[model samples]
Target: MNPGLPFLPQNEPSGHEDEGEPTQTPNLEVKLAGEPALTVAEYVSLRTEILKLIELQAQLLSLALLSLGALLGVAVQQRNSNIAFVYPVLALILSFSWLNHAHAIHRCARYLVEAVEPASGGALGWERFVRQHPLPFGMLGYWGVRSVFMGSSLVATLVGWSLPHPTLLTVIAGVASSLLTLAAFVLFLVWRESSPKQLKVEGHPGSTA
Candidate 1:
């Protein structure tokens, strides 16, 4: 047992070797202020969820790019200006969903670092380590996705506007797409600015376990 992790209960020998019985260790408990205690197993489960969300983010981006390519290809081949309008709507929906996933990932990681890791007496320090040392161009993935969605929407809008004798519906779609893209960009910026910084975890007085 790590002495730093006082919340983790110490294991004792059951002395059941003569009886050929296996000993059971108690689950490590983490108590947070005004919250129920969480077991180490639960912490592991949360970490697993974060991993899944990250993978889902990549899949969503790939889906958006693939859909954009297919839609644009078909629209160009048929020379149908109306089909081009669909790309903007698709970009808005998929990009917004991806943003939501990113927000969730950020929230979960913040909780792990700020609340759970501190409660565990810094025994669970992966989150802290990550905050202290981020990769170079770590944000490029986010920016790339944002650029792709926004660019695709703008292109779709322009395609609609370029149509000879464009209808009111086409104009409306173009306007709506531009507005949605702008709104999504603003939300993403707000989220990035609101990210919490890493906090220092103080050691408990005279705590040695």
Candidate 2:
């Protein structure tokens, strides 16, 4: 008989062996004790992946913008005014896609910091990193740079050269650009409200689990 488990049965009928031994119930305290370690492991892995994704998206954003600029240079060299209109339209599409990717990364990091990190045990550095960066679309941010350059290019395309009366395509492009700019602004507000409020690190490095 186990000395510590006084509640466990000391004996069972001989025929009970064929019926399969009574199921041994797990100790709730022991199970609960093991859970935090598992949670921490999961949080660490997820946080690392989120950080990697953020870096990857940043690189992609830079590459996309650079490609867009190069496209403009080509259009200019070829004296293709139509290409100017097409470039901004394409630029806005690419920028919006990039914006979505950035927001996803932000939400993932927010979940890790706000929920997982605290529950598993504190690792505040990740939270700090996430908060400091802010949303890419916020003022003077990466998306801001992209928006300013692309938007300016778009305005220049519409006004720099005079064409005959506004064509259907020109009017459509103008309306689309305006709508996209407003949508991007709304998205920025949503992210800002939902994102972490402070950039300050919350715990000692040596105290992390």
Best by TM-score: 1
For model 1, where is the 10-residue window of minimal lDDT?
195-204
The Cα local distance difference test for each model comes to: 0.67, 0.57
Which window of ten consecutive residues has the lowest lDDT sum in model 2? Answer: 195-204
Tell me the lDDT of model 2 at 134: 53
lDDT of 1 by residue, 1-209 (tens): 35697765565645765687744434322233323345455568779999999899889878877887887788777766677777777787887787788778877877887778877766677877876655555567446666777777777767655654257776676677667667656656665422222122222224331
Candidate 2 lDDT over residue span 28-134, tens digit each: 66788888888777777877777787776677567656765776676567655444455555555555665666667766766776677778555445665555555
Candidate 2 TM-score over all chains jointly: 0.57
**Per-candidate TM vs. native?**
0.67, 0.57
The residue pairs in collision within model 2 are none
User: How many residue pairs clash in model 1?
Assistant: 0
